[model samples]
Target chain A: MKTSDFRFDPSQVRTGYSHSTIFKEDGFGMNYCSSCGVRVLTQVPEGDHLPRQVCPSCHTIHYSNPKILVGAIPVWERKILLCRRAIAPREGYWTMPSGFMENGETLQMGAARETFEESLARVTIEDLMSVINIAAHNQVHILFRAQMDSPEHGVTLESSEVRFFEEAEIPWADLAFRTVTQALTHFVEDRQRGQRTLHLVDLETTRP
Target chain B: MKTSDFRFDPSQVRTGYSHSTIFKEDGFGMNYCSSCGVRVLTQVPEGDHLPRQVCPSCHTIHYSNPKILVGAIPVWERKILLCRRAIAPREGYWTMPSGFMENGETLQMGAARETFEESLARVTIEDLMSVINIAAHNQVHILFRAQMDSPEHGVTLESSEVRFFEEAEIPWADLAFRTVTQALTHFVEDRQRGQRTLHLVDLETTRP
Candidate 1:
């Protein structure tokens, strides 16, 4: 996979440690202060338990926390929407539409935006389906249960194609992100029981 | 009400806009490169939506997002745990044992740690009770349902007092944060219903 892949196809699912996972492993002790553009000193900030990237020049402490990834598990009747990736890490693989949440947006807003951007689908994003923490990417994946506004929209520029699949039609082995698979599985089981309860799952042990 | 109050009592419930609220209200265009101590220019980085604090000296983009706050509702019998705050915005008011989530920890880990730190109590934190988006504060509050290991512990250094409150005993008017009251109310209602389903609430209406 190359960095260029993410530029054109930024809607791909978050995988292993890129920024968040690495930072969580250690102090995320990255050098160079974005504040003062100087080499930052990594140390336990006074009276704080965790060591942060403290700027000696301006005294601004840099904190690293898990990023939130919001998306929609689009469903029209029994069919669930899927996006085929054109990016690396899982190019040609299928998964739910999701990406790193930007600043200054609610989880729902982010989910709606990502869905529209990835699949060009106008979805009525509904209740929270699952909140899965992907430790590998230092990301919290929050997927919403949604239905098509009218009909499924066109294929977005971010994906190779957009389609829907029922339980038996899902590409389980060819899914892009692990959280997508877990969410889809939950949807299937919950649909079988005729319910949509919120699921909170930790994907720490699900990694290869 | 003083800043020093936060030092020893950092576990107070989130009330009005503090640091995060103000930052979110604006673009948080504060510059001054963390690396070189130079002023960072506000401009759209490559393939980005909103403008970010980009340090020209070090060429680093500073991205900021709303933070997560996690805590647990400590229950013993029918009473829920409450902590007296010594911090500003609602000093001396009662609230749940919650705090700003720290880096390098899972949501559950942060909730457990905050519970232990604020009340010195050992709780078996269980499923997520409520995940609220406090838009005014630009924060997400994730509350869990937990049972006291034995009995409720003593007052923590971060609290003026630690005690339990039944439905009628809850100090509604004296609550430190709006989000706290909502979570506790849910627990009370859910307890009455003989079930505790996960609640995904957006407490935007509760804001001033």
Candidate 2:
């Protein structure tokens, strides 16, 4: 799917469109009122700053905010973990195991869970290495520097393939997201220097 | 107000309540349906794992997630910036100038905005110092280590008082939130050691 397909309404900020990609993929928002069951209206609520889905009858305002994406940069000596997506949107592309954060879980727990679900790897997570802002999607991507607990990890249903790749073996051209690309690039550079610090950057939404 | 009162629902985790304190305070949720103005129910959707506020009439699932709270540990010389509340919830208590992260703004920008709004201080924000999970409140508090661009920032109507305090002068017992207490404590410890690394900590909600 095109990135534009995922972009939300500017006025609404988080879920900008009356109906957006989220509604298509996650079955969340921009439909019958989650409150009163009437179709929700897109309007700026009184005393509010942005355009929100306001229920006309009960005057309830529905809000959506940027979601957190968590992942790990699993490092074992000189290699990094990589997964080939078996899912749509970016099927066949390689990525660091990552997914939407679940409720009640800390970013650390969510990142570790995604690692297990996608690669079946149990990792000892370390410092957060990256905090990438993907404004177009209203999401923040946080990647942690991690180490493997054992010698082996297997691929699950989410990943058609998985392996540890040397810096030279990274599939730069087939990477899944810009945040992923930026993070891997940082890992390579930091490795060469024998040092690393937090890599903070923003991936602006490419709008026409 | 007690921190327990701020904690939202466990099952309804971001609205953070047995019922949302936000709804009670901001009228954000926990109301009759906004669309139909009818009472909403909490139920697990057809394929979802978590319980959501679903409209019985339309079957729309209202989702809520933890909000990002951004602020700064404004350090200058050997002191830090702090604000005394001029408003309720914790009026008269001391805290780092922090607030809910807003839409369309990066975490750094949002934190800076709060600093300016709370203390009238123009600050050059540096590294994110902490990410404390306040699960009970359905919030993740992100505190940054910051510096003042100039010697002074004005106090606004929101702050009954604004000033810098040495580590000794920090009002430990009278502090506003645990996040504030933890951030301040980190600042003091890091200061004494003459070396500071990112202090990644989770201030868990201690429920009775």
Candidate 3:
């Protein structure tokens, strides 16, 4: 399935739709108040250092924070599963099954759910692999090492192609995002060292 | 420095202001659209599984996800620093310094910021201690172990009292949040075992 299938209105196309632009627009582009429908003013609320979209009528200060993206690297028979994106922000590039985390779910649950959604593969979420902080884009990517329940996997709406790759066959240059590369690299290195370690990375740039 | 000091209007009081209720209201209590000033309707958008607050006029779907609370367990000379909250939901209860993670900051930066905000102590954030998913409240609490830069510390507006506490002297009964309790327990246990291991906990209930 294409990413446009997820959007309700196709005509309102967002040009240059990178992840940073999408998050910035969704997070800070509040024109009216959600509580009272009044046009909100961009000002610093009392005792607040940062300016927020504050409603003058209802005295409500709307806050926007960084979002978390949960994902997992699924391993089956010593091969890692990857999904080729059917979406934008680097379409057709391979990445571990991941997406924005939903509410009312644990990190493990989100990872497993994203894996199933993208690759059509059921996985048991394992230990935390990497916690990448993309502070510039206001996103935190959390990835886990997962064990595939079975070898059964197929393409889904979010992924046009799904397949397993050995360590030597990983398409290093065609990875979708920097966080994906970081997680996959760490996974490979730790496996070679005969250890499982959690990596915390702070990515300062948007370069992939 | 009561919690009311943070609010602009004290008369608009939230009765029985627990963490779950606060998050529930903040995460799902949308009435009007933020994009357009029209009243939003609760409906499932096309190809969406869950109901969302969707704007009829502008076709903007407001997605609410779980929030991240970044905190630090500050240690100075074999003693842990704790803060007595001056706010509601657990006023006067002891807790490690913590608050909502902000935009444009890494997890370590947020942990240190909250540590200084509540306890007035500058700290160098260390390894991740615990990641507790409070899914029932639509929140995830990430705690880190930190080393104090100096012995200097004081109380802040968020905390009525702040001081160092030995493991035996920690007031277990007066601790504020369950996530805090879990993190502290893990910290003490890991220190005793002479190993630093990250703890991942999924708290199903709101019981403190």
Model 3: per-residue lDDT, tens digit, A53-107? 8899998999988889999999999999999999898999999999888776778
Q: Chain A TM-score per candidate?
A: 0.83, 0.84, 0.87
- What's each prediction's TM-score? 0.82, 0.77, 0.87
TM-score of model 3 relative to the true fold? Answer: 0.87
Ranking by TM-score: 3, 1, 2
Kindly provide the TM-score of model 1 when superposed on the true structure, using C-alpha atoms. 0.82
CAPRI tier for the interface of model 2: incorrect
Residue A46 displacement (Å), model 3: 1.6
Clashes of each: 15, 10, 1
Candidate 2 positional error at B32, Å: 8.7
Error in Å for residue A43 of model 3: 1.7
Q: How far off is residue A50 in model 1, in Å?
A: 1.8
State the iRMSD of every prediction, in order shown.
13.9, 9.8, 14.8
lDDT of each: 0.70, 0.70, 0.81
Candidate 1: CAPRI quality band: incorrect
**What are the per-residue Cα lDDT tens digits for candidate 2 across A115-141?**
877887777777777888765566678
* Residue B33 local lDDT, model 1: 58
Q: Which ten residues in a row have the lowest lDDT in candidate 2 chain A?
A: A1-10
